[model samples]
Target: MVAMWSYSAGYNVVEVGDDVWDLIEERTLVLFNHQSTSDVPLIMAAFNSRPNLSNNIMWIMDHVFKLTNFGIVSWAHGDFFIHGGKQHREASLLELGSHLQKFYIPRKRKWLVLFPEGGFLKNRKASSQSYAKKNNLPVLENVALPRVGALKVIVDNAAAEQHTDDSDKIKYLLDVTIAYPGGRPLDLPTIFGGWRPACDTIFHYRRYNIEEIPKDEETLTKWLYDRYEEKEAILQEYYDTGIFPDAHTTHDPKFEPVETNRLTGQRVVHDTLEFILRHIFYIVSTWIWMSFLYWVFTSICQLVW
Candidate 1:
């Protein structure tokens, strides 16, 4: 499905390095950088493009999965990674396999996909640095890539747990950057520019992992975060030089403080009105929906009888 969209939409994907996929094929735990929401499907298309990587991508999704129809659709059929409840902190190898097998794991290879940043981050450079520091991983301060905590989880799991004899438990970070030819690189605002609804179909695969940091579980968590602080310093230096631009660095000057009249009195009146309306609307909507459903079900029962 994603491949077909990519083919139709004319989105071009550039592979930053070939070794990235090589690590992938070798059953490495893969961590990808988060840009726009477009990241996921694009990666799916890229994975499909490779003959050897048909069904090895797994992702950890969040709670919006229940509230929206989009969530239902994305994971309805495909093989991906996910965790819920206290299970996430204590997911056993057997439990991981149970979810993993839903997507069809091979007889011996252990492959996984993850986004470590938790969710979309507005300040990628700073957030990535902080997360890296906390996890004892090196930070790519110049550019916001994958967060280290998620990678730590994968590493710790892989290191402590055993897989098949043929399975090699290695870790990798795939840093993907989205770009447009002759156009600006995609960012948070631009991707959702037109009040566009859910990104059902879009083709975009910008950056594949260029750098690889290999570490064992015991030391990886601490080592990864230390890298973030180092990355922050490097980024600060890069910003000073104007050499390569550090992403998410504020450069505009129009941002200035503005003063507003004190609104405590007016705010009190408005809040009172808003409170009344909020309850009225909530009760009204709930009653209407429930009443309509009840009538419909009653009519259906009568017709059946």
Candidate 2:
């Protein structure tokens, strides 16, 4: 469904990494920059382009998303939802950590997607800028300041889990940065209406092994901020110049792009056929219902006369 929607909307999603599959094969935590609601479909489309990456995947979503139809599906998929407000923030993170620990199993390939920015960059830019200025940090234009509390909880719990069972280790932290070339954010309505953005959607993925990250909360918090700072630099560069520099670099050599030719062709054909069949069914059903209504109306008129 994501692939069909993206392709139909004329989005050309390109993922650059050598070991994309290996990243998924490990106990992975995916951190991505959130731009718009369209980011969900775009990331799903990327996973769809690869084989088996979409399986055993879960997302950390804002609690408000759970109120939508997509939220129900996400809940069924074992995704976590958190209230981002000040009142429920701490409780939410604790609950999330508990859920992660509960669901984690040794040797199972699982990927948890997290957006540490807490909200969309555009919506939080003013506050981010103010906070950065107050703290004497550089003002970020592209990415927002990452809230580290949730990440700290997640990492601590994962580390504890690993300590209890050495086999249940977190393999890598995949830092994914998404950029829109034309600086226009894609929304659902725009995508469904086939309003293609001027440039292709690009996703840059880099992996940091768990051992490389610090165990201490303070150090880990700094590390998380540094990662977001790097993302800010990359995105700033992208906006300044219309290209992402050296986007294909990866830490692992074993990552190879899956053979997508066969899968893509089969999917395109399948989606097209399904679309046509659906329209035909809708048209026939509507015609039948309208015919029934007309017959009933005529019969009632004759009885009254």
Candidate 3:
């Protein structure tokens, strides 16, 4: 994976807005839109080169990553395991979450990446309304599926540690939506092709600020619903204006909403199923490769004896 992206004919991936970077300096939480596989790596590579940013960046890697050829790629960088599931029982995996949070936690709050969209996608967008609704329940969201495990953990942990409504600690959040100009969407092929030369692949990131958080659940729900509606409008302006998306749309409540990729049961099911299959293959391939190496080593030892 690194080889592919590293060898790309022309590296067009660039960070447009400094809102996220600026906010992080003041201790803020950022919920970014996940569009392609390159999202995390691109973010890591983008910030890794920055000498001034001190926040320790970490990402939750699924269990199957241990099996992939690129599994080590993630680990060597800032890869982490999603809380619970296959990795939860593994003591080392469970320990990593706490360890990383502390490791990355500088003198102040850390600059972390949370993929609230869960996994990379083409057109799917889950609003803040949906997230708050799910938070009302004790069960939380799907287990194996990626929702906002990292975010939930951050909130819960903060509340537990501070023994206060740490929710208030989250003074700001940037809702980053990655959109492609020229009416195109990102896909696996183009993601892989991201390593190659491409003129039409520019992705525009739109940032929105969560200006307020309701004190109660009911107000929070309404706030989230209104927030996503606001997000939809900002996306349209991106098409209308060539100027990069920023935190300018919040002041206008009357902005028109754009048609969205409606949420569906089929899309949810597909994402979960695909994530499972990817991990299964990862584990199986990892086991096979490990076994092969073990056999080769034993065979050589016996020959020498």
Candidate 4:
């Protein structure tokens, strides 16, 4: 997907945070802000250089997405396609909990990626604000108030006391904030059709040990909201100043920003290499599928004739 984006237009992805790659190797719960449908390419491009991390991660996505473009491949990779809306909400979360307990460790997944906002920012922002207004919480504009049900489900299974082996459970909380150029997000059309002046996919990452995060329902709910609040601040600052905060600016001891682009320097070799291999596989598979269809059609026509 990133390759296709790059091929269409030289889309660049920037990664910011400490120069540590340890969290990528650990059993981590990664939460991303849902901004647009085009976000996946950026995430893929970010970790594409590290195949172990990118390839081994499990995604939590909408059930309808299970029938979309890359849905079949996601099925092959064993990602959880969760149902959406209030009607299926409780059952979906229960199913998610069951899915995690059953497959998270057994399938050897290192990262569990979630968008706790439950939907895209544009779609959920109004309802999120209304809920905030009713509950006397801060009205967030940049990011939605995260639904804690999935987060609770994750922690209860992945970080709770159920696992006998400490090494097998989640050890870190990865907060990834995605930003597009000038606060303008790109969608599937923009990525596929490409754009002039190129589009930048900026990713800001912050990691905390699972021990530092709250595990209980109430505290964890507040903890999740607090993170979204921080995300709103971070995004606001970025939109206003065209740059994110550093320690001196935000007084955050955990933030040590080191930026890198995945498409530049020696990484270009890695990206191009993967691009060719991915395209080749897709092309060959598509050809084989077409051949089978052609054979079936020809046989039916012959019988009719």
Candidate 5:
């Protein structure tokens, strides 16, 4: 993503709010609104300064994503993919809950990332709205109604699961609102071509302590729906103002601006020099891991032959 070497397009994918939120170090359950296939790559670029997250993060994704170009990479990275739609929803969630209970501690996963809307807004919005109409829930314009099944499963089974280490457990839920400037989301080509977004794709964050969040099914589902309501409101305001308003400042709550504790910018890894340095670091690190893999492969081949 550092390919944005041009004078005009070389802008950083900006992180706007909640500057002090410990996104990098702490164990987290992150909610991201799915836009296009490019969101994951955009996240990779966002993690330019926090490269360990790129390696260690666990992504919970739609089962259909298995057919995408990134599928095998996700599988190799150990991301979780569960089937979608009502037919398989219950079974898939039950399976996911079971898997999380068994895997979270042993896998040493620090962050769990998922899209609660179940599908992209473009594909699922109409159905979401219809369901809202039937169920008497709010019909949102920017985001589809989020399905709570997976969220519930993860919260019930994975939230507090942790290694015996004294590290802080999954203590936070990061509600991340990703805005593609001018409603134009990035595509997969950017991974190879670089971050070519004419303007920066801005990220807004709100941190909630897991201890403060509701745990029961009914309350948790209500809390998630309330969050989607806030997400839609944020999106609408972003479209109107060309900026994400700090919820604390915008007649809303928790969306504080990070003037004193900015996360990524000139202080972060956005410069051309950092980009080159990162390239060098990765080039050197590549040999370290690849050499181990090479030895493993050769040893296995010798044993078989």
Candidate 6:
């Protein structure tokens, strides 16, 4: 459904690295900047583009999202929901940590996507800027200050837990920067309206090994702050120059276009078959719903007459 939505919306995704998919195959934590609800479909499209990366993904989202249709689907996917209210914030974090410890096995291949900023950049920008001013931190333009508590808990637990083998012990962290150059922010309404961007959506991926990150909470918090600061700089550069710094570019030789089936032999054919199956499923579902409604209407009319 996500792939079909993305394709129908005319979302052209340009990924920086091929190795990022390999990292995902390993137990990897993916951190991305939150822009809009459309980010979910775009990210799903990114994972779907690669054969190595499975769409079996989990997300860390706030309780408010659980009220939406997206939230219902996410719930089915086993996503962790955290309460954002001040009263239950600490308790929620603790619960989230415990859940992560139990849910994510070291040997399993999982992609845990985290929006460390906690909310959309546009909504949180003013508060983030005010906080930065007070703390002498750099004023973030593109992204907001990341709430590190959840990150700290996840990293600490992952580091402390013992894996089956030495290779499995080290998990990769991919800092993915998603950008829509010369385009408006994407939302559900925009997508439903079939609004296509003039330019392609660019996803910049940089990998960080788990062993490279500090395990201690305090240092790790600072590390996350530093990472966001770097993100801010990268975004600032993009806005000014209309291109990201070449130093951050991932020149993956194996990277191929979505239309190309060379990377995975039967990918294009498989995707076409999946698309057809999805349409059939939708058609059958609509027919069932309409038939039930019609039966109910006829039963009511017969009783009244």
* Better by TM-score, candidate 6 or 2: 6
Q: Write the per-residue lDDT of candidate 4 for residues 64-103, one digit (tens) a residue.
A: 8788777887888888988878899899999998888777
- Model 2 per-residue lDDT tens digits across residues 101-144: 67655325478788989899889789989999999987888888
Clashes of each: 16, 2, 2, 0, 1, 0
Measured over all alpha carbons after superposition, the RMSD of each candidate to the real structure, in angstroms, is 16.9, 7.0, 12.0, 3.8, 5.4, 6.0
Q: lDDT for model 6, on a 0 to 1 scale?
A: 0.71
Model 2 residue 16 CA deviation (Å) reads 2.3
User: Which structure is stronger by TM-score: 2 or 3?
Assistant: 2
Clashing residue pairs for model 2: 18-255, 19-255
lDDT of 3: 0.46
TM-score of each: 0.49, 0.79, 0.53, 0.89, 0.77, 0.81
Highest-scoring model, lDDT:
4
lDDT score at residue 49, model 6, on the 0-100 scale: 63
Give the range where candidate 2 is weakest over 10 consecutive residues by summed lDDT. Answer: 260-269
Q: Which stretches of candidate 3 lie over 4 Å from their true place?
A: 1-8, 14-18, 22-27, 52-55, 61-66, 72-79, 83-109, 123-150, 159-172, 186-197, 200-225, 239-305
Name the lDDT of candidate 2.
0.73
Please rank every candidate by TM-score, starting with the best. Answer: 4, 6, 2, 5, 3, 1
Best-first order by lDDT: 4, 2, 5, 6, 3, 1
What TM-score would you give candidate 4 relative to the actual structure? 0.89
Residue-wise lDDT of candidate 3 within 1-305, one digit each (tens)? 22234224333344443234444454355555555665554454345444455344445555566677567765665556554443454464436446445543422444555665445444333433354467663221111113444554554443234535433244445554454554344444555566434532322333333334343445544544454455455555665784545544243344322421221111001133434565688789989999999999999999999
Instruction: For candidate 3, give the lDDT of residue 91.
Output: 66
User: Scored by CA lDDT, what does every candidate get?
Assistant: 0.45, 0.73, 0.46, 0.78, 0.71, 0.71
Deviation from native of the Cα of residue 23 in model 2, angstroms: 2.5
